[model samples]
Target: MARGLSQPKRIVILGGGYVGLYAALGLQRKLKGNEASVTVIDPQPHMTYQPFLPEAAAGAIEPRHVVVPLRKTLKRCHVLTARVTKISHADKCVEIEAPDGHTEQVGFDILVVALGSVARLMPIPGLAEQGIAFKTIGEAIFLRNHVMSKLDAAASTVDQELRRKLLTFTFVGGGFAGIEALAELEDMARFATRYYENIEPSDLRWVLVEAAGRILPEVRESLGVYTVLQLEKRGIEVYLSTLAKSFENGHVILSDGTEFDSDTIVWTAGVKANPVLATSDLPLDERGRLKATPTLQVEGLPDVWTAGDNAAVPDLSRIEEDPSALCAPNAQHAVRQANQMAKNIVSVLRDKQPRDYFHKNVGSVASLGLHKGVADVYNVKAKGFIAWGMHRGYHVARVPTFNRKFRVVADWLLSGLLRREVISMGQINNPRAEFDRVSRS
Candidate 1:
């Protein structure tokens, strides 16, 4: 359609994550006058800004502000709210399961696989039923309400054991997701207790269990140590080099012979590539990730490209040092890779070779709680309020879309003027109850 020709090239992008959304945006901007038809297929209609999940969970920011609507953002691209069940590269088709229980196959001239990772679960007993994850906006809202409800239950309970158990919070994984969620929620809980006469901040038992020897491995070892100390100062029990063995019946049994009862068990340990890739005809690595070259193209497969967590993209910045080096699966890499992938795709369409993706590690930042954080940027370290400000400023700029950025900033400003919203609308979790009661009446 670019040159007034019919049947424009069809480019299908799987998943509406950072990689998928950004790639679609880039493609729409570059492909003028329908040079190509870009179709983005994802179960969700919006892309969740994961870095802000903790703030949303803490009620520091509204949940709605943390997600970018794909339809609104990608005005030029076709957005499909459906699950991609399988891909047949040989046939240039993908099987899609629609929301209305219908299935269909969609054909494409170029395919972009960006289906991200899912929670890396284990065989631990009771984890599936008792544990909650901190990945989505829904999970963040649920957690905020759940934590508040636990406090309400604790304040009303006469049994000391039940109250203690309700106040005990256990978080597994010391990574950004786990640590940030734990810190933010803990801060919120501490603030919420000021209104309850029966509850006190000192009564809360916050525990962090990590299998590795250190937390915040993204930062320097010294900074990681400092983070542990800061958390310890806040009365949080930091368990390093420990594994969560079992979580049966709200009872947590750790590898280090520590046992505790808690109502909340947050699992943010790690994530693995989406299992949906196994059904695809595309070549995959041992870890079940799509095998991609330095230029973001699928290995030995033309017209197919991959990026993000599900793609084993060669890290050219590290390949000279380590031949097997692959890009670290993070938002920073996903975003940059997506932009480069789009450029490469356009270049290929114009009869040119694609360039390899390369970028050096800038650094990492982690917020312990409000007004408390640690950051290592370009080999320089900062701690406390300054680091926290840097964390917020960096994320606020990277959250995508001017509309979303304005909304998020407004939420932050309003939160400063008003107290944190601790009210738990638990009934939202069971909306059918009222309807059922009315029907029976």
Candidate 2:
């Protein structure tokens, strides 16, 4: 909390992602001097708009523009570049561990638990040491570089078996993340094949494995069926109701008794709320998400609110008819919930009545590539090129700051008029390459 503020309530926001940044920005705009002091605690100093991740992976946009600087944008809020190792809701304080390995306890009048989800993982044999996840910017860039490097390896290799494995890409999970990534990377690889004299489009193989009966379960089944067909039409294999039982020794084994050898494995299986939720004594739901009320507040806790993928906010809109339709963890709900959470905080401070959190599902849009997409917008379904355009348009408008919005738009415009660059700066993967060369003396 900042100094020279007497009796001013301190609002502590956890997580600097979409939810945290938006809520803090709204609170700063809604509250005045001495009204309340906002402090945002997060491990990263910036917030990433994840919707643009596929484009970044496809090399359509610059990676740096995808993240918004929390300190620069949320100037009014105190930005602590530290991880919230533990939270003490009962005592109205949180314990944050700094980058240099120091711990400190910070008190708060209002606690906002928005420590969003992390890539849900299991103790699958060899997965921990081999699989790569698509969650952070660093991971996105790594995957991009890794994919291009594999293409280079395949083109230069003389062994047929080695070339097949190097060019083969396997993605586990059929959700939005997996499908979009497969689509974008497939598009990129197909485009990149033109530059490789020895590598053709048919040389690369793309496979998607899903444990569920369908992909994009958030959309209607009809659309899911269409998505499978569309992917199949483009030579992408989709395996339904199957899980990667194990990837031990580079052998991909599915529950359906299928096995394949591939050099690249991308895991987008699912996400669970941050394990930090367990570090605190907060009330959690069956799936380990914080149990939050319709108003986005903790069920029995005062001045403590939760949102994003980490909080299980009840879907009263659908709870009566369908017991299983809780708010699907997506960006749409996060944005609306953050706005309402900010207003609720301001309302509590001013002794005003807090409003209930109610939002109609506005539908979803996903891009397969530059000209391929699937969307069900407000009950109107669209596919192919039009849907792809809508997907990019929706995300460009929703990507936070205008600076990022413009850059993303420019990238799209340039890509349409020019050839996609398939160059890989592999040196990014090894920062010490130059130092090592200099030290060889």
lDDT of each: 0.93, 0.89
| Candidate 1 RMSD to the real structure | 1.9
After superposing candidate 2, which stretches have Cα over 4 Å from the reference? 1-6, 323-325, 437-441
Candidate 1 global TM-score: 0.97
lDDT of 1: 0.93
Per-candidate TM-scores read 0.97, 0.96
For candidate 1, the per-residue lDDT at 332 reads 89
Looking at candidate 1, the ten consecutive residues that score lowest on lDDT are 1-10
Q: What is the model-wide C-alpha lDDT for candidate 2?
A: 0.89
Q: How many clashes show up in model 2?
A: 0
Which residue pairs come into collision in candidate 1? none
